[model samples]
Target: MGKKKASSHKFLALAAAAAIAVPAVSPAAVSAKEHSFKDVPARYTEAVAYLTNNGITKGLSPSQFGTNVSISRVDAAIQLAAALGIDPQGTYKNAGFKDVPKRGQWAVNALAEKGIISGKAAGLFGAYDAITRNETARLISLAYKLTIDETVKKTPFTDVNAQWAKYVDALVKSGVTEGKTSSRFGADDHLQRGEWALFLYRLAHPAAKELDLTIMHTNDTHAHIENAARKVTAIKEVRKAKPNNVLLDAGDVFSGTLYFNEYLGQADLNFMNLVGYDAMTFGNHEFDLGTKPLANFIAKAKFPFVSANVNFTSDENIKGLVTGGIAAAPKDGSVYDAIIKEVDGEKVGIFGLTTAETVDISSPGAGVMFEDYLEKSKKTVASLEKQGVNKIIALTHIGFKDGGGDNDVTLAKEVEGIDIIVGGHSHDLLKEPVLDTTGKEPTVIVQANEYNKYLGTLDVKFDKNGKVIGHAGKLIEIDAKGEDGTYILEDDPEAAEILATEYKPAIDAKKKTVVGKTAVALNGERADVRTKETNLGNLITDGMLEKAKTINKEAVIAVQNGGGIRASINEGDITLDEVLTVMPFGNALAIMNLTGAEIRAALENSVKEVPGQFGGFLQVSGLKFTYDSSKPVGERVKTVEVKKENGYVPLVDTESYVVATNTFTAKGGDGYSTFGKAYEEGRVSEPGFVDWEMFRDYIQANPNAAPELENRITDINQP
Candidate 1:
C-alpha cells in the first residue's frame, strides 16, 4: 500500500462527495506521527507504517502499535470514518442510541447516518464491545462501496453465517482478505488492530484485475501412449506461453491399445504424471477390468480424481480413498466430488462427472454404482459455489451431443453455474470451442478427439465478478509425423526414455508375436461393423461360442455387439497386438439362459436403429434372421431360425436357449434391455474366458481362420 498524502487530498475529496463538512486539517492530521512499533510482526510492518504515516492510527504510547489488541466497536467506527475522509469531531445529525457516549459520538453518528454502521440493539450501540470480523467486513464494504458478489452463496469460511456471507463475499472479491484460513473465516473472532490496518490498506489500493486462465485438456486418450512424447511437447509449449495453466484429462485413460492391455493403465498414468495432469474423471472403460484394477489405478494417481456422479462407497477398495464433497485443499491420489484450485490468486472450482452408462457398458461390478449425472452435477456445482467458488469447470466424460445418453451440450444448457466443460466419450474433435449462451452465463464446451490425436487448449478471461468475458480454443495436433512422414516435433527426452526403457520392448515383442493368420482381411470399419454385420464381428462371436461350448455344451447361439469389436484383422499373420487392438476392452465371455422370445427381443434391439449404424448390431453364429428396414423397430425382425443338425429350423418362442456373448453385451450394454433383464434375473453366468484370448485360441486352432458372413443378418428391404 502506498503512503497517503499528509495533506489528505483524496480523503478531502471523498468528504466533499459525501457532503460531510469538517475542519481542513482533519483529525487524521491531529496525530500524524509515524513511530516504529517494536511489537509489530514482520508481516504487518508495512500496514502499520501505512496507517501511521497517513495518521489513520497513532501508537498507544507513541512506540507500541498494539497490533494484537482488539479494536472496540466505537474505536473501529472512528477509524473507518476518518479513513473515508470524514472527521470524527465534525458536526452531524445524531443517530438515536441511548448508550452513545460523547467520546466518539459524532463519528458513530456520521457513519450510522450514512448507513456504514449500525446499533447492536434498537436503542443501544455496542460502543465498548470488540468489533468482529463480520462487522469489519461490513464496515470496509460500505466504506469503500465494494461490489458485493450476489452470486456467491457462501464464503470460504465455515464459521460465517448466512447473513454475513455477502459482506464477506464482497471483501473477498475485492481482494481485501482470503478469510482466516482456506476453510475458516473466523467470522466471530475479534478484529485485531493489525488486521484492520491491512484491510483498510487493501481497500484503499484495490487490485481487482481480470484473471485469464488457460486449460490444457485431453480426453479419450485410451492408452494411446505412442504419442506421449509429442503430447508432452505440445503441453510444454502451451505452459511456456501461458504460465498459469492446468493440464486435465476428461477420462477414458484406460482401454484401447496394447499398452492398457499389458500394463492396465500404469503406462498411461506414468505419462500423465510426466505431463502433470491436474485432475481426471472416470470413463466407462476405466471400469472395464472391474473395481480392483480401477482401485489400483486410483491408488497410483499423482493427481486427485474428481468423480461427483460415481459412488464407490460400497467398494471396499475405493471407499477409503474417496474424500466426499468439495475439498479446498485436495490431496493427490484421492477422489472428491469437487475441489477448489487457486490460480493467479483466484479460486476456480473444478468437478468431475462420468456417464451413468458405465454400469451398463463397462464392468464396474456390483459395489461401484453411478448416480444420475444431472442431479450429481447440480449438487456438486452448488457445493462448490457454497464454498465461495464462482469459476467452475466440469471435467466430464459424457459425450458431446450424444443422443443416446447423458452428454456435454445438455449439461451446459441445464446446469446454471457451470462456466466451462472439457468433455470426452463421443471423441468429438472440436476444432473450435462451442459457446452456449443459453444459461445465466456463457459456458464454453470443448473436446479433444479420441486416441491421443490432439491436445485441446482453452483460454478464458474472467471479469472481476468471475463471469467469462472472452474465450478462445483450438485442438493442437499431437502428431509426431507430418504429412511428408518427417518428425515435426521433437520428443520430450524423459517421456521418450520411459517409453523406450519401460514399455516399448514388451509392446514391440507383442506386436511381432503372431497369434494366427487370416486368409481374408476382416472388415471392422465403423461404418460397416456397426451397420451391416462384418466377417470380423462374426469371427469374434464364433470364437465366443467355441469357448462357451466347453463350459456349457448347451451354448449354441453366439452374439456380440458390433461396438465391442474395435479393429479388423489384416489378411496375414495376426499378432497379439492386432488381436488386442480389436478386442481391447478385455470383455470376458458370458453365457445366458434366455427364452426364444427374449432372444427375438434382443435381435429386435440390435436392428432397431440400423441402417443407421447402431453399435448394438448383432454379429451372430448359429442363428439367422431377416429384418425389413421399412418395418417398425419392434417388429423389424421378419423371421428367426435356429441352426440344428438338419439345418435351419423355426424358432420356438417358449423354448429356452443357451446363448454366448461378451460380458458387456450380456450385461445389457448397447441398450439391450432384454439381455440386461436376464443378467439381473441371475440367468447369466460369466465363464471368465477373456474375449481376445478366446479369439486367439480359435484363430490358432484353425490356421485357416477365414470366417465369412453367411447371410447371418439380412436387411430384407435392401438388396
Candidate 2:
C-alpha cells in the first residue's frame, strides 16, 4: 500500500507538471549540467540550461551562474523583456517610471512601453529587493499572455488574501499551481525549487493544438465550481476524440460562493490553472478584489486575455499589464471584425463583444465601461473584411435576445457580415447551432450550456474565400459517463501520507450529508420554461402568492418571469443541491397593490405569444386567463377570474387587490410595460423569504398538489 501510494504521488506531480502547455524545448540541443556554471546552485541547473538555450537569460560570468542570489527589480525586468524578445534599444521617453537610469534602461523601458511593469513608486524602481515567488509568477504570466483553464477541482487556501486574489485566480486558470492539499494552497508561502522549475517549463512550452478547435467558454464563474470536475473530464474527452479543440473562459471567475467568501479567489484560481485553458476575455468581476490583485492574476494566467473594448488610459498599474499588444478591430461589415487565426492555411478573423448591460450590473469599482457592442462589432467587422479576411467568429457576452420585447438578436444579427457567433450571457443552453438565413450568406450562431455543465462543439468547413462550406455542432453534456474519477489534488507527499493515515475518517466525514429532499424533480429546462408553462412554474408562482399573503391577506395574484425558474423538479426525493440549482439566483419577493382593471391590462399584455420569442409571458397562480392566437394583439386576453377564499370570483373592474411577483417583473422585464405603470402603494409585512424556500415549504405543506391548466385568463372573440 505504501509503494502504491508513493507511486500515485509521483504520478500526480509529474502529470501536473507535464499537463502544463508551455512552449517545448528540444531535448537534443542542451542538457542541464552543461549550463551549470561554478557558482550556480545544483537546483537551478535545469532552469539555467533551459533559459540559456532559449536565449532568455545569460549567465553572470563564464564560470558562475547566480542561482541563489536574489533578482533585483531592474534586472528582473531586463531578463523578462529579453525572454519575450523585446528589443533592448528603443525609445524610452513614454515608459512612465521616473527613476529608470538612462544607461542599461532599455529593458525596463521596453517592458513598460509594452505595459508589463510598474515602479515601486512614481519614479523609483526598487531594483535591489529580491523578487518573491508570487511576483515572479505574475511577471512571467504577463510576458507570455497566459490564461488559466476553467476545469481543475477547487481547494481552499490560506494566506492569499483579497489583495493577491486575482493572481491566484490566474495561476489556477493557467494550470500553474494546485493547493498544498485538497483543502489548502498556502499561496503566500514561498514556492519550492521543483515548483519554480515546473513553472518555467510551462512558460517556455505552451500547449499545442492537436486538431481543429472547439472552445467551450464561460465568464463570471463567481466561485461556482460544482460542475468543474465534470467540465474538465468532458473537455479532455472532447480533446482526445477531436484533437484540434480548445477550451476557453472569459473573466469574472472569482467571488460568489462560500468557497470564494472563505479564501477569496485563490483556491479557485489554483484549480483553474491545473485544468488548462486556451484564452479568456476580461469581465468586470476580476476587479472585485481590486487593481493589484487583478494585476497579479494577469501575471499568473497561462492563456491570453483579449479585451479590445476596455481602455485602461492613464493608470500606471493597468497600463503596465495592458501594454503587450492591442488586439486589432474586426474588418468592416464582417462578423468577427478583426479575429486572427490560421485555419487550414486560411486566415480566420475573430473579435469579441461584451454586453452593454455590464455597465449597469458590474461593480462600480471595476473602473471600466463597456463600449457599444453593436457599433464596435459593426466597425470591426467591416475593417476585417477590408483587410482581406473572410472567416469571422465573434466571441460575445451579449445575450441572445434583448428581453425587452425587442427582436434584436444581438450584434451578430444586427450586423450583416459575421460568419459565426460564439455567445455568452443569458446562459442559454443552445442545443444546436442556429443559422441566420437573412443574409446573402448564412451566419451560424451557437452557445454552450452555462455553469460548465456542457461544452459546445461547432464544426465549420470554410472555403478559400472564407465562405462557409458546411457547419454542424451540438452541446455535449458532461455527466458521470465522461468522468475518470482520477485526480491529483495535492503536492506534498508527507501530507498525502497523513491524509492516507486518516483516509477512512475523511471518507466517513464526506459521506453524503443530506441537506434537504425533494418529493419531485423540479424542471427548469430553458426550453420548457421559455416555450411553455410547466408544473414547476405553477408550483413556484403559488409559492410567491402564498408568501405574499402571509404579510397581506389581500395578496391574490402571483406572477413570475419564466427565466427565474431555472430547473425542473422530477418526481422523487430532491436534495438541497437540487433546490439551489432550481433557484440559483438569490431573488427577493416583492408585493404590490393594483386595481382589477390594471391587473387585467397587465395580464393581457403578458399573454401575447409570438413564435421564436423567449421570455415574453408571465406564469401565474391564483388567476386563470386564456388568449387566442387568431385574435389581434390588443384584444387577445378575453376572460379573467380570481380564486377567492370562498371560491372563484370574476375579477371586478373597480376592486383593488394585492399582487405578488419577483423584483424582475416589478421592474418590467420581458416587455411587460404595463407592469411598469402599475403602482406600488404599500409595503408588505415580510420581504426576505427566498422564492425556492417558499416553494419547498409549500411542497411540504401539501404533498398531493399538482399543476392544473385551468383557463383562468384567456384571449378574446376568436376563442
Q: Please, what is the TM-score per model?
A: 0.56, 0.45
| Model 2 C-alpha lDDT per residue in residues 622-649, reported as the tens digit of each score | 8877666567767766677888889778
> What does candidate 1 score in Cα RMSD to the true structure?
17.4
Give the lowest summed-lDDT range of ten residues in model 1.
Answer: 3-12
Model 1: how far residue 368 lies from native, Å: 1.9
Q: Poorest 10 consecutive residues of model 2 by lDDT?
A: 1-10
Score candidate 2 by TM-score against the native. 0.45
lDDT of 1 by residue, 517-564 (tens): 989998988788888878998888888888878767888899988888
lDDT of 1: 0.79
